[model samples]
Target: MMERKLVFGVAVGVAVGACVVAAVVVGRRVKSRSKWKRVVRVLEEFEVAGDTPVRRLRQVVDAMAVEMHAGLASEGGSKLKMLLTYVDNLPNGSEKGTFYALDLGGTNFRVLRVHLGGQRSLSLEHDVERQPIPEHLMTGTSEDLFDFIASSLKDFVEKADDPDQLVARRKELGFTFSFPVKHASASSGVLIKWTKGFSIEDMVGQDAAESLQQAIDRIGLDMRVSVLINDTLGTLAVGHYQDPDTVAAVIIGTGTNACYLERTDAIIKCQGLLTTSGSMVINMEWGNFWTSHLPRTTYDIDLDVDSPNPNEQGFEKMISGMYLGDIVRRVILRISQESDVLGPASTRLLMPFILRTPSMAAMHEDSSPDLTEVARTLEDILEITDTPLKVRKLVVKICDIVTRRAARLAAAGIVGILKKIGRDGSNGIAGGRSRTDIKLRRTVAIEGSLYTSYTMFREYLHEALVEILGEETAPHVILKATEDGSGIGAALLAASYSS
Candidate 1:
């Protein structure tokens, strides 16, 4: 009797212990669900705040047009720096010559030579050589950097068709300096500041073209730096060379900027602004553009606050490839902090910019039923492990939301340019004619990894354009991607402005 009683007590204790363990497990699951709900609420709020409805996009378009007008009216009238390019005429395929181009924008620099065949030729023949800059030269003196560039150019020229022939005549070259520049002419610009890991202090506030020209002379290479342009102008030049309909160029790569042909009379900032064609390309430094109409979110505000150049390049922070990944990361970080859905290693999400745009794109584009890529990206980049399938879906949703906003905003920017120049279906500020009255075909040249590589981004951008312009007027507008636009276009401009 005693043995049986003892056995009963042990069984009861074991069963009770099991019950308690089961209840604890249930409590944990309930807590997890609550946390998940909180995260979803955050996401929902972000989505609502991030939405750029067609109505709102139109507002953005209008604001952009107004800002452009203000900037063109005076030097300091608005945030948009509508600087003049002094390019009176674009290359019309009548240019026939061998011209050289030097490209210095970021970590790497390139040299390209273009051979044009004139009116009878179908295409321009061009050759390009690219090399990485030594780490030390980026922080070195202005002379050191230019001398390295001049040396590289000299070697490339000697290896080409005729070293003696090249030396026989002064070669015209175009310098595509993709940095902050204040141009004095088509062929001359003062460096505003160095960016992209370059720390050449002496180059600031100096003539970029003159520096290159001096370097060319030092190497005994008789070359003239004919035009100083940014990558956007290069894209424009290349687009026009290929298609005369192209009037504007936009660069949406690691950075974003735009330039368009504007009427000389409209550039009121320059009292006597004159061009042979009555139009000159204006660099709208569109990155600095700002307006209350933009559907800004808390993410944008935080990003701007944390960035090196706060309150600057506001538009870029919201739409550029460089910041897109960071935005997604911030979203995920918020989720991780509020929930255990992503597992125990959530601390890794704290790193800033650890998630690159390319990685975010990979996750977004993953088409597998199980979303293996998304899972792998999370594990690899954020050290997040064993995330549920729904969590992966949530990540995809966040990427879509962020990317769609950027694409739509960029579309509004493009339409704004149209509105400013009377190319938008609607009449200009005066609103005299129907949007359909202007039937001329317009092409916008675009270059960059964002538009060319990201399929979804391109689709969203196109959809927004159609929505903003309506189906009737949207057909007349074309966004053309220019490959090697910067290098080849620079060479073409050199030929057009050749002495």
Candidate 2:
């Protein structure tokens, strides 16, 4: 009996020891889980659900309208530099002829020849050649850069047909200078500043059209720059040519900006400006637009601080494709630092723009049950390994939150434009007017890779527009994708402004 008692005691002690061990293990896991939960809570703060509710969006709309008015009121009255594009007339599909467009927006410049057919029955023919701007030339003298462009144009023109034969006609070219410019006329503008990583010191304050023309002359090319326009105006021009109802244009790729047709009388700064159409395309330069109403997060603030142009392009930093992926990276990096779910802090995550917007889009779009693409992106971009499915899901949620916020904010901006034009409400620009009195359809011409290439981004933007505009009024507002509008629209402008 005594021996049996001893064995039973020994077994009881072993069971107690196992229980203690299990408790310790469970406690550690619970603590780890709690840490992850904290990370999730931090991420949730970045969400737009509470930050950009419908009420807040309405406020954004109001603010946007006010800013538009302020910007149009004077040169420096608001953050929005409502620069005049001097494009008094948009293409109306009556243009008939072969025109050339030279696009110098980014690292590559495209030379295009477009054949326009008049009215509804005319067909369009275009041949485009893209050439990479030499790296040295980007930072070289303005003359050198323009010379290179002129030489390329000459070569392309010679290849197309006999240059001498065209000498009698003197081919027309539309120049799309994507940077900020102070327009002197439809065919000329002075460069205000260069953006998008371009740092040509000599280009500022110079006449961009004149420089290009001088280069063309130096190369003995018989092409004249008939219209000097920006990419947003080009987009609006093309959209108008396709659908006359398109009143505004927005670009949402590396950067974001919008342009809209405004009554000449509304441009308070430039008095006595006369145009045949009685309206001119106003480059909103909305990238700089800001109000206290913007739902900015810590991540956004940090991004702005570190950006090359701090305190500038606040809206662009939040919504543009160039910065969205970095925003996701920053969120994930924060989580990794605060928890063990992502394993360890990665140097790759520390690198700026290491995770591009496309990768984020891919991960966000991963529909697999296991989220294989998310896991793969994590491993490839951040070198994060063995991320549990839950953690991978968390990463996806981060992407969704960032992208959704961007898309929704963009929608609000569009709504703001509509409001300013008196298209959002029933008043229709005239007080006491009924909805039925003026229910004309409105279309916003949008270009850039974010709206065209990113499927999820586009869907979210569309969904947000419907939510903001309501189902009844949403159908009246259309967001049309005008791909390569910058290039094609320039050609159309050349035709419209032809002498």
Candidate 3:
């Protein structure tokens, strides 16, 4: 009886131990479920916040048009700096001359010599030399930076095939300085501020064309800075050179901006301004554009707060290539913080901009059955390994949400430009005109990697345009891609305005 009792007690203890183990296992599964639920909630919230339904996009379009009008009405009237570029004539291919162009937009600058053959589109020749700006020079003195550019321009000109052209007459150059410039003339513009990693204090409020001219003189180069324009104008010039119907130019690249041909009378700030064609190009520094209609989320807020320039380039932060990947990163980081589904907290995910836009695009466009590209990108960039198929799918959804919003917002902006010109067929949101009454063939010159290289982005933008303008009206508005606008287009402008 004593032996049996001992055996029964031992068996009971063993049974109790097994039951505790099972309870713990069940508890862990429940906890995992809870964590995953939180992750899903976060994603759902992001999606809802980022939703750009047709109605909301139309609001954005109207807001953009209003801001454009306000900006054109007066300086400092709105966030949009409707700066005038006194370009009365868009090049019609009648320009026949050997002109030089110096493009200083991003980290790299290029010098080009373009030879235009009096006729249209038949004989335009160019030779380009590109050089990366040195790191120290970006923050260096204005004189030093200009001197470096002038030195490069000197070297580029020495190798030209037709040296006689330089000796026969003073070389005219169009300076495509892709920065915020406030000026009154086509030949010169004052640097309002520097963007694209340049911060030359002395250059601010100073004439950029004059600085370049002074440098050219110091370096013994015989070149005249004939026209001062940004890359947007360059794109417009190049686009109009190819097709006269191109009325506006848009840049959807690392940075975002647009310039459009507007009637001289429409610019109310400069009331008596006159142009030969009765039209002028207005640089809509649309990157700094902001209105309450824009959809802002926690991710965008955090990204902007952490950015070097907070409260600036608000629209650019949402739509430009520079900030898109980082925005996606912020979303993924939040998800990781909320759940262990993505495995142990990836330290790299905490880092900013480690996952670039190209990588994000790769992940978003992954079409494999198993989403192998998404898996690889996560592994390679974020150091998150072995993500299950479901997790990969979730990542893809995040990318789509972010990119789709950006593309749609960009499309709204395009429509806003059309509306400002009375070519969008909406007639300033009154919507009273018949299709034929407002139907017009309008072409917008677009340049940059976002529109040309990213297929998904391009498609989404096109889709939004169709949704906004409808099938019949959308067909009339064209988004044509213009190449080498900053390089060759500037050369063409120099020829047109050359002395």
* Candidate 2 whole-model C-alpha lDDT, 0 to 1: 0.86
> CA lDDT of each candidate?
0.89, 0.86, 0.90
Q: How do the candidates rank by TM-score, highest first? A: 2, 1, 3
TM-scores of the candidates are: 0.93, 0.95, 0.91
* Residues 272-382 of candidate 2: C-alpha lDDT, one tens digit per residue: 988888999999999888988888888888899998889998888878999999999998888878887788778898898999999999999999999999989999888
**Highest-TM-score candidate:** 2
Q: lDDT tens string, model 1, 128-232?
A: 899899999999988999999999999988878755446588888989998889988999999988889999999999999999899889989989999998889
**In candidate 1, which residue pairs clash?**
425-435
TM-score of 1: 0.93
lDDT of 3 by residue, 1-499 (tens): 9999999999999999999999999999999889889989999999999899999999999999899999999989999988889888778888988899999988999999988888778346788888999999999999999999999998888887775765756889999987878876998888888887898898999999999999999998878998988889999999898888888999998889999998888899999998889999999989999988888999999998998889998999999999999989999999998888999999999899998999999999999999999999999889999899999999999999999999999999999988887789766643444557556688999998989999999999999999998887898999999898888889989988976
Clash counts for all predictions: 1, 0, 0
